[model samples]
Target: IADQDEHCKKFMEALIPEAFRKLQCSHPIDHWAGWL
Candidate 1:
């Protein structure tokens, strides 16, 4: 449904950034700008 799609979109918007930050912190190497 449209509501589910909206919810998934928001959830991903929320999670992806934090996850990417954690990933960058965990691995401090080349291409770290992906976190920002």
Candidate 2:
């Protein structure tokens, strides 16, 4: 249905930015930094 499509779109738009910020803050390199 069109309503489901619209809702999914809105949910993704809301989620992507927060996911991006968390991805940015999550530093994988920091884990290796301690070994060096």
Candidate 3:
């Protein structure tokens, strides 16, 4: 978002974070005892 492209920022902001969230959410490491 620090770049000069407003359109790119908005498009990437919506798309990139969603991809990472799904990737992180699907990871099975959350089930571990020290996961806290």
TM-score of each: 0.72, 0.71, 0.48
Give the per-residue lDDT digits (tens) of candidate 3, residues 1-36: 556698888899999999999878877565664587
lDDT of 1 by residue, 1-36 (tens): 999999999999999999999987778754565766
Backbone clashes, each candidate: 0, 0, 0
* Model 1 clashing residue pairs (backbone): none
Better of 2 and 3 by lDDT: 2
Off by over 4 Å in 3: 1-4, 29-36
lDDT of model 3, residue 31:
62
Which residue pairs in candidate 2 collide? Answer: none
Where is model 2 more than 4 Å wrong at Cα? 28-36
Tell me which of candidates 1 and 3 scores higher on TM-score. Answer: 1
Among these predicted structures, which one has the highest TM-score? 1
